[model samples]
Target: MMTSLFDQFASPTMLGIPLIVIAVMLPWTMFPSPTPQWVTNRVITIQMWLANRFTNQLMTPLSLGGHKWALLLTSLMLYLITINMLGLLPYTFTPTTQLSMNMGFAFPLWLATLIIGMRDQPTMSLGHLLPEGTPVPLIPALIVIETISLFIRPLALGVRLTANLTAGHLLIQLLATAVYVLLPLMPTVALLTAAVFFLLTLLEIAVALIQAYVFVLLLSLYLQENI
Candidate 1:
């Protein structure tokens, strides 16, 4: 089996570690960007110039309440999807599969929710977590429950994405390993197993994209709720 170094760890960590590395490496990719440094710098300068030119010309621009947020989220989705799918390469790691990477995204999401919610409904937003309709006697319990729930949203998001990607990658790795392990003992069965693993890799690509979209969609939904 042609396995990457990332596959050496326990199943959970196999995807987790690479995912974290990928997230940390994201910003650095811009420095010596996949493109030539000079090219990248020129592109950046041109983009800035164009953006400034547009800003000066625009007037009475119709904007959504969350237009900035939407653009930010779209950038996030593009970056995450690109990085996650990059793991499909022969020896690359997928950072989206790591706890740290997922949590990095989740933390911002959690904070954004709170900030936007409070901004949108200053007096009612934070307070409405418990809702006025709740019985006065249960307000304390409700508040506690809502607080816990709000905090857990990011945790759930992190765990869900990390676990899904990690499990999928591990499953493919194990299946591939099994093919090699059994090849000498039973050539026919081993070949069939290897074929299965090849199919599994195809499915994993789809899973990777779905996971990225799900994470972005959930984040958007959270912002929508708050906004």
Candidate 2:
């Protein structure tokens, strides 16, 4: 009757419908819609401030053309952060821990940047494959290497997010199991294990926020290169 640690990552269902659909949609309702008022609540104020700051920081490195993505990227960032933080709650599934979901977000955005670069500035886009001043002997090798690196970006993005969240979740479950088992036999050891579990939970919360930010930030960098 014991459950596997990774069983928590599996998508739950209700009436045979995947609960992930609900999990993804639930975060959107957590935010309040903007109101037309002279003074807004503190929640609205703080949310606006965070959005502005994040957008500014994310767009600073890119050209004006990249500014067009400010809305899309900002919205995606908030959605991701909300999902990640919510997943930390009890009985919740973290969809980002799944490779398919992470890649669903990563690949299309990465490809869009590449397409924009190719469409608007084909020379510069292709030039990225081979740097200037390369020796004749090294030209083919360098081009092949760069080409492989370029295609690997999306895979790296998806795997990085999935790996980090999955690892954190697994460690947490292992520690929790240890604490429970130890409590029945060794009180002192159980207390120490519990304390470590608490700290690791806090760290996981931060990791959730950070991984979401890093995902969006990398997307922006890819866009910058294209723009």
Candidate 3:
């Protein structure tokens, strides 16, 4: 029997147990632990440098109040980057591809930003629901629209990450299947498809990294508006 094209996305299982729990725990194990000594291993040193660079870039636009989010943002970026990149490897499951997982990440954090903004600057936070210099005729309609969009932020964030990764994985699987089937029947065409598949894999790797960065970047922007 032919297998389902989408079966690749099903969460892996072993002895009737889902592997997602393990997948979530796996990323943290990759990071090298830091030492108390002044000098450190190259791995830890490089990790710290990259992390600092990410925080510096992420926090530069925010006010002093937002700087406190540096640790949260940096940790999030690393967690996402590791999970996304690892998913590209064989025999791996990407938790981020699931909307539930993405929303779990998005909603709480997005809500946190909103809560911070409202707590710190209630007038400004509420003002975002209705912009300045609005005509009376458009006032009610604009308020409705803005309120809808504000709540839509977390949904958009969850969907964007899930959709992109799912689409890329689906396309990669389809192309690889085509190449495998045509290898004997049509050598030249199979060769072309194989080349395309190779290029597509590289693009997917970049997407994994870029999507992680964009996720964190948007969070930072949300925090900026609030704090």
Candidate 4:
């Protein structure tokens, strides 16, 4: 039987148990924990530097109240980048490929921002629904449209990450299949195809990193409006 190209995305199972849990947790285990010492190794030094840089950049625009999310957001960024990088490895599952998983991450966080806005600044939150200069005739229609867009934010977040990762994986798989097929019939073309596959793999790596950063960046933006 011919196998589907999309089958790589199937959630891995062992003895009827889904392996997504392992995939998610495995990345964290790979990270080395810091320790107290006169001096640290290069790994620890680089990690500390990156952690500090990321947090400072992320929290720069938010108020002091929003700085409270520094740990949570920084942890999330590392978690996502780890899983995404790990997924690029052979025979590994990417939990973020699942829309359900993506939604699980996006919804609560987005809702938290919305809740903060409504709680702390009800007037400002409601004001966003209608612009100050909205024409009289378009007031009702504008409200309806903005309300719909507001509710759509979480869905957009989840779907954007899922779709970008899914598309990249599908393209990589297709090119790989082509390389295998061409190897037997046309050695020269197969070599060129293999070259392209290598380039695509690099692009996918960048995509994984970029998508994770974009996801967290958007969440920060949402939080900024609230705080």
Candidate 5:
């Protein structure tokens, strides 16, 4: 029974081909491509509006060098949002919930920011390890601590996304199971549970959107520091 609860998280396969690959690629098909018309349809207009707004907001805090990432970050934000929201549908697998996949998304991007810092401004980047005006004795220990924290960023990014989505999914499943089991035995309790489940579903939807945004937002912050 315990094992059954987590079965949904197992990667689905067909004749040894992983369905995760399909899931990751599916979101791209949902967006409508723009036409050559001078004025576009409402869907394309809204897409343009949202993309412009997000790009403007994200680029606000960034330096001119960092502005180059605006397009990549905006597209990533949309992709994540679509993927996360789609997972909330019945019988769908969320790719972001897997640690390995989330790490794949996080590590390379995190490393890119690190590389930019090291290559462009090695002194300034290393200086981030030690605070200004530190005591002679504390410098070594602080540098070591900062170094550990630096390396841990990607791990933290992956774990945060995976943990939040996993926990929410598990709770929703438990509540669903409770509703199903209690329906005949205790109609009133089951009704209440179903109501709670409905509310939780809404919250989970919000969480899906927020988590995607937070993931991208953190990447931007990392880029800000480096650039």
Candidate 6:
């Protein structure tokens, strides 16, 4: 009768989310702190390696730009991948499955877009956001609409990842419950449910990566268009 933490609190809510928070954070306290032995975290190591490669290369301006961007994007992708895989473990809470956590990550991304875009080319950033040659009369209306869309990006990003992960997690939970119920009476049904649960695990892995790619790709598009 082995089960997981997810099986215990599949119907999560505001009240219970705190418990999940504690569960997720407990690892930080439980894991032995690293000594000042210059231990390298995987993401940090990758970032340093990429930075060194970029610095060493005699790249053209355009080539250098592409290399820098690719490295930056790859780092983001790796980060998301690591977090998503951590969620697949037993007794672990997937923070990304929570709306608040997803919003936390996504909002900063939108803010960076705004700050970077404006800093690099304020006139073009604000002006280019609207259509190239719209009449002055309609420009105000266009700006309002475009501004709303720009803000909505973070909201959309948060909801998309949270909703997808939440749904997949719930599906696995429900299937596991059904399997538990039918185990003695209908072993075949229970076995089928178990098989489906394994499949869902694989599917969740893909969803995690896909959502990360989507977030980064949309961001890259915004940067390219504005800057």
On a 0 to 100 scale, what is the lDDT of residue 108 in model 1? 88
Model 3, 1-227: lDDT tens per residue?
88887787788899999999999999999999899999998999999999999899999899999999899889999999999999888778999999999999999999999999889899999999888999999999999999999999999999999999999999988898899999999999999999999999999999999999999999999998888
> Model 1: per-residue lDDT, tens digit, 1-227?
68574553322345445344444466436433235454457667775564455333221132366556654665566566677677677655676776876899988877887798798766766775778689899988899999898889899889988888888878887898799899999999999998899899989888877777788777766766666
Clashing pairs in 1: 16-98, 19-95
Q: Which segments of candidate 4 are over 4 A away from where they belong?
A: none
Among all windows of 10 consecutive residues in model 1, the one with the lowest summed lDDT is 54-63
Distance from true position, residue 95, model 1, in Å? 1.9
lDDT of 2 by residue, 7-77 (tens): 98999998999999999999999999889998999999999999999999999999999999999999999
Q: What is the TM-score of each predicted model, taking all chains together?
A: 0.71, 0.98, 0.97, 0.97, 0.97, 0.68
lDDT of 5 by residue, 43-63 (tens): 999999999998999999999
Ranking by TM-score: 2, 4, 5, 3, 1, 6
Q: Write the per-residue lDDT of candidate 4 for residues 82-162, one digit (tens) a residue.
A: 988888888899999999999999999999999999999989988889999989999999999999988999999999999
Candidate maximizing lDDT:
2
lDDT, residue 116, model 4: 96
In model 4, pairs of residues that clash are none
Ranking by lDDT: 2, 5, 3, 4, 1, 6
lDDT of 6 by residue, 34-143 (tens): 34658867766775675466334312233333345665666566566666676777766677777787788778867876787688778888876598888999988998
Q: Per-model C-alpha lDDT, please?
A: 0.71, 0.94, 0.93, 0.92, 0.93, 0.70
Q: Name the TM-score of candidate 1.
A: 0.71
Model 4 residue 149 CA deviation in Å = 0.8
Q: Roughly what TM-score does model 6 have, to 2 decimal places?
A: 0.68
- Judge candidate 1 against the unseen true structure and give its global Cα lDDT, from 0 to 1: 0.71
Native-referenced Cα lDDT, model 3: 0.93
